[model samples]
Target: MRYIFILTVLLLSFNTFSQPISWVEQTSGLTTQLTSVSVVNDNNAWICGYAGRVLRTTNGGANWVSVNAAPIPLTLDLHSIFAIDSMTALVAGSGSSSFLFRTSNGGANWTQVFTETGGFINSVQMGNAFAGFMMGDPVGGRWSLWGTTNAGLTWDSTNFYLPQAGTEAGWNNAFFFEVTSGVWFGTNNTRVYKSLTLVNWTTQPTTGQVNSYAIWFNTPLTGFTGGTALLMTTNSGLTWVSPASPLPGTANLSGITGFGSQWVVTRQASAIYLSPDNGATWSTSYTAPAGNFRHIAKSRANNLIYYGVRSNGGISKGTLLVGIEPVSNIVPDKFELKQNYPNPFNPNTTIEFSIAKNSIVKLAVYDALGREVNSLLNSELKAGEYSINFSAADLPSGTYFYKLSTGDFVQTKKMILVK
Candidate 1:
């Protein structure tokens, strides 16, 4: 899993912030129900759920440190966690059965590595520190692949090959890995499986998408998902589209992290949207007081965003600005397209627009089923402020859609290459 098409230049500093964004409530003295969360930045973070709870936070969340699973007790239910930083990590569980634990001092002590009883272990991913991957749900009906280069000691659910149908399972935190674009999950039938090289596998069929229950990828062709509806696959999942519904009442989505361009979606027990363009549109950043949210973790060291409120068991932390504010000498009143800076991009990303008067211009790119791969610009500028330097190398990851026209002032935005 090694594909590198580098070139990342993002130096935008206008500072902007607005939108229904607000979430701050962290103090998990445990009430149960935290399904999952793993953030190794912005101060370190880690969380699990139900009975075998295992919370942690280095600083970002203020203060939270309750880690003790000793011989794996407390009844077991830790959905999944793979923190790989603030001192190594890896966790997995599922009530009446299933297990896998590992720690290197951070959690004080843990070391079960693997276990099996009936079925259960919905997600756990680790791309370095000795490779990693674990996803489960269908024991006999297939769908349960494990692999660990070494970190977790030893594991290898037998090479690979997942196709069994009949009642496939998976969707707790809906597993998704990326060491170059390799694992992905979300199945309860609606389908959505992929594998760049986690042992060759591929599936697609979330047509209208339902039961997709959380699957994320900000690169590897940009992805996002949630059960019953709400889906978007810039090509990584093969083909999937239907994005709007961050929480119009509820299509029943559950946990989805963020990266490329901020994101945080969770709508099972209702609201918690928040997308700074990477998801088209979304607002109500956080709103869950009753009982159902499973996961949402992002903190690539500073972005900071964590939440998992299984109804009262609570756990929250926030820091989402949506950047766009700093303005002293701003300029531009009419024509604008700006929405493509650092967006799920890899291999260069930067595109700004603001031509209020000048004429003849084109700039094109589309592919997420729209065709028209690349065009860049067509020319006759001179308006005020501009910024363009888009590059995808040769394209491969997925999701693309850019249009700018000039005369009547058309617009279109969405970019992701991830290769």
Candidate 2:
């Protein structure tokens, strides 16, 4: 009786610790295909879609109010949006008469800041409250790009000259901007245009003949682009390669966003993929029964929270809970490494440990032949309980060993990858 009770309690504890992470659906109350979503903070976000529809949620999506009826025409197709705050935002519409609109009073009124006759506005990004850039398809043999320094009150087209490739065009929300490192945007010509000074541009070829739609960089050197194909670069866009583990679906990828080493990508179909260790491995975190997820956004106030917008007015929220998480702030009395959860994990598992004092730690994995297969951690940490996620997606099924060492305490444990 005593042995059975202990086993039951252990099983229950394991089940509680390994709860699956997922995306919960939210009500957006519209049927238009939402093209973009921008999250300003934990409590504020904005979504824009076809029919010039704009929805603002000040209370973290508890309710969304339509803010584009009077000044903005119903025939406009808003492609991208950037929210500066709960009240200030800019939306760009594409197609024959591409236009950019700005709202300062939370959407009661809007001002048309910029418009072009034939070009298409693909993206609008703000470095802050004042400085921003708008990217568009090429026109008159040049990429239709503009920059605004005084918020969205005015735009300048004289500072940069980006010549476009023959018949090349930009995709919606397909650019990345870092204030200190400049900007990058992908195109349909199997090229990615980058500008360090936002004045002179250079183009780099991806791995294959691909239509690059989603571009994101953790740093200037390491980045990923997805559209017709998923490609990654580690040498500042000098070269690109495919990841070892292929993504699950065949649909084209539409959006990519990340916080630290965690990444979330949306497909043009009904699925969203998540990677806990950068792009080393991926899993389908959520899938809708109908429609497709067009773009994804991460909250500026919280790194864990993410919002994914569907084509047919659906909103899904997901939290990244499978990374290196600090479990306790209380200092531990001794150093120890607990066995990993789900001993025979397929490709993902959690490893928990405790540190007695501030120390440099190294946790690594080795294959049966004693070859170092992966390096999970090599950093200094304070005395506390920590949980780390380990992914073996690229490795073959085999018995492996993981070692945790801090200060003079060292321990090794065995785990199995069944697939």
Candidate 2 weakest ten by summed lDDT = 1-10
As a TM-score, model 1 comes out at: 0.31
TM-score per candidate, chains pooled: 0.31, 0.73
Clashing pairs in 2: none
Q: For every candidate structure, what is the RMSD over all alpha carbons to the true structure, in angstroms?
A: 19.3, 14.5
Each candidate's number of clashing pairs is 11, 0
**Alpha-carbon local distance difference test for all models:** 0.71, 0.78
Model 1: per-residue Cα lDDT over 110-180, one tens digit each: 89878877878888788888998888887876767888898877788886768668877877778778788
- lDDT tens digits by residue: candidate 2, 165-260: 788998998899889877999898888899988888988887584688898887767788867667887787888788666667888888988755
On TM-score, the leading prediction is 2
